[model samples]
Target chain A: MSVTVIIAILVVAFLAGMDGILDEWEFQQPLVACTLIGWLLGDVTTGVLFGGSLQMITIGWMNIGAAVAPDTALAAVGAAIWVCGPAHLTVAEGLAIAIPLALIGQGLTVIVRRLVVKLVHYAERSVRQGNLNVITRVHLLSLTLQGLRVVIPTALILLVPTTLMQTFKAGLPHNVVMGLAVAGGLLAVVGYAIVVNMMATKWLWPFFILGVVLAAITALNMIALGLIGLALAIIYVQLQSQTRPPSGPDDEMDELDRELEDL
Target chain B: MTSANNQMPKTLTRPDLFRLFWRSSFEQGSWNYERMQNLGFVYVMMPAIKRLYDTPEDQRAAVLRHLGFFNTMPYMQSTITGVVANMEVQRANGSQLDDQAINNVKVGMMGPLAGVGDPIWWGTFRPVLAAFAAGLAQGKASLIGPLLFFFGWNIARLTFRWQSQKVGYSLGVTITTKTGNLLPKLTQGASILGMFVMGAVIPRWTSIEMPTVIARVHAHDQLEQLTLQNVCDRILPGLVPVLLTLICLWLIRKRVNPIWLMLGILVLSIFGYSIGLLGVK
Candidate 1:
């Protein structure tokens, strides 16, 4: 890869890490990470496209409280950078490497968070002393640490011997690779099941099944599919609202609907 | 009025603006203190801090501190624009810029804008681009795919930054009046677009086909032949993909982790390939 491209990738990784630490929701997700990495690697479009595909597969995935989803930021960013970078790997191949990279990324995040806790204490002292400069420095320090989390790993991956890497990849039997792909597909289904169970209501199952069927059969685009699904969801919500006993205020009902809508 | 009114105006320069923009853009990645300092120093301050020597120390410090917090590029742009506008109005009205107010505005807007902008920019837009690129990858249009990806994303990013800054400036008077209800509607629209592209692209990009078996029935003096496709059509048309999907569903319902599931599938595929159970052409 060109030195400029490598620098760009490193910058993107650093930014992605910052996004995660800042809790900029989308930044931590694959969409932005992949796009930025892709753009820097001279293929923004592919980066965005791959990022989006991975986004859907992990649509219902979230890091609620302590439960960590696969580190999509790493997967998306790493995949794009590797595929669109000097590596020139196909999306599938890039993803094959990227997925494991995401798991490793998650480990890095855990370590960063643990380290950040100590910094927060330092910030508390700065705040008590009325040292706004120190407080600001502490914030900067935290963000830098987060950026390093991504930069260090990505640099290492890029720096590794390509021939050695190829041999390592080749050493895995064909069955193993295919089996992993199948397993990934299956796990995606499991992720969907979690969402389905969370949104359980007798009437919605039909719509859910209908969605699966439609997705399986017709070659309708996601936009068309989403509109259909959204329309159905809205109708279902309205009907359910009407049939229910009037036991609450309008605001309360709205809140309940909003909560349900989120699911 | 007697002493404060006689103070010289704090003249802002181009470098001040550049510093602000640079800081905002670099801060886009700040998740913690270390990242903020490193990125802030390298990407933000290093470019503009030298210019600060010509300005008043307090103003310089204020500007530096303002750029310190966690921010995304667009969010940072919007927040900085908002603060600048606020300062301009204060200057015009014969009052010094309220440091707390500027900080409040910066901190206040970053969260919501980041919340909305991040997902819309990354989750929705990027994926649509990836879907197209995946098709290109399949076609071996290698260079074209990546080029298209970059063009689409930068256009979106730059547009968002400009639009957000405009909104921040124009609506500074009653910023709260700007509602985010519009976001969900926009996201809904984008989601539809995103999914459509994914559906069209995934099959082409990924290996999702299955092998089929055929059985024939023959009479004493007659023989019959049937193709795998014909047999499949007879017993539930388009069964293979559906069967694959259903199998995925079954595995999902069992609450297995994706990593383990992936490992399982890889093993199964290799086994099937070796045994010739899954015919590989």
Candidate 2:
């Protein structure tokens, strides 16, 4: 890769890292991160394709309550580099690499979050001393560390000789490649399962079954299926509201819903 | 509860509210396990605290109050920030709301909001939307897929943050009493949508196919062929995908690390493919 391209990839990695913790702009998600990296590498197709596949695999990886899911920033950016850069790996190989990276990234994230405790303490002390700028400075500095978490790994990965990656790819057995692809195909199941674990209730299983059966039997694209889902969700909510008696005046959830509706 | 400071601005100005909204987006910038967004909360509240509390002691107290443990879904923190901002304004205007009262509201709201927000945004909305966009990306090899997700998510998120903050501010102390069935109801609605989409994506997105010929039968003087994949499709088109999803769900419920599950899947796929029990067309 050219110097400019390498610099751009690092920049993308940095953004992905910052967004990993921030989780605000979603630059960490493979869909965006890979696409940007791929665009930087001059192969948008491979980048996007890898991103699309990786997105499904990581879709259900969520931070619910206090539990942190695996890290996507490093996984997405690192995988995209291999697939879209001089490594010339296939998307499936890229995915195979991404999974382990995600695990490692998850570990890194916990460590970083732990270390940031000291920074928070420092910020607290600064506040006690009445220096408000330390709050912003410490926060921004911590965010930069998050960006580096991915960038440093990515920089190291880029430092690996491109020919070595080619040699590694060439040495893989055909069955291994095929198996990796098969694994890739089946990997999205894990993400789906996580979502199911989170959202599934006895009452909700039927919608899932209905969705499966409909998609299996019909030629409906995802957009069409999604529209049907939206319609059904709205219908179900409406019927539910009509049948269920309002809880007494303390029903804050209903008020919150009404508040949401006004928005 | 009358105060001596009738001269102080009793409410945050529009500029102050905007500053709060803008800063709220970075609420997790300093996330740490020790306090879990305590500093982030302080960071977000700094602008409002500066605007409302003129005295050094009151400002110090306000900062100290928010520095306590505070964590929730990142997006949902906006509502808490709004409510807290309102309380700060009242306290500054001579209301009897103590630091404990402020902390009480923070603790009280974070749990419920996190419960609702995590599933709605992270669980339901994001997965559902990303599934669709990924499909588009893979099916068409188009830039629109990622673009759609990027814009779609941010638009909804930004709007939610803005509106929720406003509503929380306007509701103020009333929000404490306003809690009701909305939690289960919204959660149920999101679950319904989420489950349905998940089911749909299994068949549409997951690509497990058993292309290996499991058996061959010749009953009518002519050769007959049967593939395990064909049998599976005859039974149910997405049976393998569904079964795999269920197994993963079970294992996840059993507390197996997802990384291990993924590594297991890799091994299983290689083995299955090598043994001709699984194949890709």
Model 2 accuracy (lDDT, Cα): 0.88
Q: Against the true two-chain complex, what DockQ does each candidate achieve?
A: 0.15, 0.73
Off by over 4 Å in 2: A245-263, B1-8, B178-181, B215-224
User: Would you estimate the TM-scores of all the predictions?
Assistant: 0.59, 0.94
Here, model 1's chain A TM-score works out at 0.76
Q: What is the alpha-carbon lDDT for the whole of candidate 1?
A: 0.53
| Best TM-score among the predictions, by candidate number | 2
Colliding residue pairs in candidate 2: A252-B178, A252-B179, A252-B180, A253-B180, A253-B182
Q: Taking the tens digit of each residue's C-alpha lDDT, what string does model 2 give over A1-263? A: 78999898899999998988999999999999999999999999988888999999999999775688999999999989889988899999999999989988989888899999999888888878987778879988988888899999999999989999999999999889999999998999899989899888788888999998989857687778888887888899878777666644435687989999999
Error of 2 at A199 (Å): 1.0
